[model samples]
Target: MTPGRLLVTGAAGFIGFHLCRRLLAEGWTVRGIDNLNDYYDPALKRARLSQLEGHPAFTFQHLDIAQRDDLHRLFTGSRFDVVVNLAAQAGVRYSLEHPHSYADSNLLGFVNLLEGCRHQGVDHLLFASSSSVYGANSRLPYSEHDPVDHPVSLYAATKRAGELMAHSYAHLYDIPVTGLRFFTVYGPWGRPDMAYFSFTRKILAGESIPVFNHGQMQRDFTYIDDIVEAVVRLVDHPPQRQVDWPADPATSAAPFRIYNIGNHQPVALLDFIATLEECLGRKAQLELLPMQAGDVLATYAEVNDLAALVDFAPRTPLARGLAEFVRWYRQYYGTA
Candidate 1:
């Protein structure tokens, strides 16, 4: 079940980089695509790319998924066995400022990927969805069976849209598709916009860290390694025809499936900060702020289906994962 050539979009991104490295380690030829956009810091993305620069099995292309022609060219050229679409205009608040960016990348770009997979005869197509799609739902632990019709933010809406779009493609074209609902993914080489990374930077600089939602938020913070592990396992196992898919409106008939990949343990925001402080050996100056627009109060993922299907689950504790992240941060930035 080895992939001859794997195409990973957003290779320079946090998750994409890890997935590509893992694939290469497993003796697979990996082709990566990314625009190197200045979403946060292109330098960080470059640093991530530098880790895979010398790998003979890895090839990278600097192209945005929004560019349909360029993406079509790559698809036509590579004819990948597996396609993992991680490239997206990612941010809840940023979506409010630049809504068009989300439309271009998350919507148009995603359709282009589906088209490429459909035409190229890709075996398995995996794409990143978000826990944010569970918006405004007070459900204790969000499940694949739960209704995601009420998305609070534009970003969440787009992610939900991507899931539906993937389902449509899977049904019409018979492409095997899996949509992953990631819940508060964080670890080493993480996004700077994430609170854990920013808190470490501010704390080191003796600055105040903003605690959103007046520090009442909780999240199922999953580690990066665990995420990559789940993805790699799922790569070998594509969705099959659900012969007994319920007609109760909760299940679908397509060769498409969605799973929640998370730690399944929601940690309070204040407790997570405490873990960070312990990891970095510094106390953070906290400034409590009201919840911003397009923000959720909490996110808890129910990953039972993932565990049952893949026989593996994300188990990294926040304390351990943050310690690894702090170590990487200190070494990368020369802060310690």
Candidate 2:
């Protein structure tokens, strides 16, 4: 299937930048937009954009989706076959302090994007939801069928809200929508705030790394390559209206679907650190700490729905993924 034009929000961020590059490589004209805020390092975001800037099929825009007028203009001015939204005010703990940012980006910005799709009529609208929405579920392997009513963090709440909003749009306007519940996606050129990225840096700098929950936590640590592969395969497959649906929350009588994309293999925090140490050839000084606010004990995703839908399964092992990240980190930071 050939795509006409595509618009990717948060195009300079970790996932967005990677997705844009892949789209361009597959001959899709991608219009990439980002606020490039100093949530982490704007320089890193710019660096990611630099690689895509040289590509003939890529176009960059310095814009924020929270700005309704700007976003409206972009959607009206351009025709997009698919709109892959990867932009949001990320970070669970950070949302505790800067609550307004989450409201603006994840809540308001999300509504704006949904409105755009509703008006313009895109073939498929895919947005990045998070596994964090499974807050307080206590389930071992979180499923899309599991209810996500209790989100401890504002970030998670906002994501859950986005899903609801998307469902409404999908039903009202008949726009095809897919919500991806990504589980701890990490790899080369990942976000600095992520534990793996920060751990690698602190370990290389000979500093003690913070281990939350006294290293008792487990994560379905998915790799970026696997994440990208699932998304690329899903772009062509839009969900149809299921009138005979047996009250499944994941899909309904509307053109809406949700899938959990993860490695489905939860790794212990302690063992994850050990792998990183081996990859860097240096052990980390551990600062074991109690569980922080808005932090969950574990996140093990049941990617069965994703596997069945797109024939996708995240196969990247933590050690292998961390090794790749370590290699990129050393080269990117001149640590080696």
Candidate 3:
């Protein structure tokens, strides 16, 4: 009872892992590919893969998208209906340290994906963009309609580059494409590099946690389930070129669109830490620090277009999501 075969790059990643599980549950034949790079912990990535190993409709492939030959071979053999490109070297500070990595994976790898989708004639291609693309904007809630010309970080620049790249392919090849601008996504089985996850670990170990920007930061923290729900809904609703397509950067005459998938609520850094403390039943020792390079003061998403299109929006409260994450953290680490 499978709907169609779909290819999800970075299938072992945090968001990709959750998306793969959801797609498999819905009885879709999923071809999950990942390079399994040691970006954080390969062990954690393998653990996620272990959960999907026995699924009847899931197949795992170990290959780097940056490797042109392997990627071409994959697209030549498999006739996929949709391709979700979530594979990228993620992290703002890390991007500063590893600019070449971002160029290799986020830039070159994405071109390979576009080429694959073009040749394979993929019905739709959904990719993971970042809210960080709204760089240097003083606006309260970032919107798709806003201009995203200035990117403060290499990571954000690459993500914005991906959007432009995808738009070009859609215009040239008429491939239907959607770019999701995810904001501060967090939940169970999340990346350890994320502040919440690392903060939990440090708090449990009675260590000091670094509070950046003098604890003035805010984020539109979206739950993993909410993200999965939004993505699932949009999969059935590929972007169609509008009859009266304006000369706008947000959309195009091509079948391409971008949506900010996030909880519109922006929580302050101190309040978020308080919620985490309540969840873990422990207070954190904070070391206030200046804002790091390639860091933003806040991120709030304007999801009106997403709501209008999907008839849904992310509604998970921060307290509940943090509680769930804490529960999983303690159990996963045997610290409960």
Q: What would the per-residue lDDT of candidate 1 be over residues 1-336, giving only the tens digit for each residue? A: 765889999999999999999999988899999999998999999999999979999999899998899988887777788889999999999999999999999999999999999998789999999999989888889888888899999999999999989999998998999998888888878999998999999999999999988899998999999999999999988887687788522246778889889999999999999999999899999999999999988889898888888897777878899999999999999996
lDDT of 3 by residue, 46-97 (tens): 8899989899999999989999999999999889998899999999999988
Q: In model 2, where is the ten-residue run with the lowest total lDDT?
A: 308-317
For model 2, the stretches where C-alpha displacement exceeds 4 angstroms are none
CA deviation > 4 Å runs, candidate 3: none
User: Which stretch of 10 consecutive residues in model 3 shows the poorest summed lDDT?
Assistant: 1-10
Cα distance off (Å), candidate 2, residue 113 = 0.9
Query: TM-score per candidate, in order?
Result: 0.98, 0.99, 0.98
Tell me the lDDT of model 3 at 192: 94
- Considering TM-score, where higher is better, how would the candidates rank from best to worst? 2, 3, 1
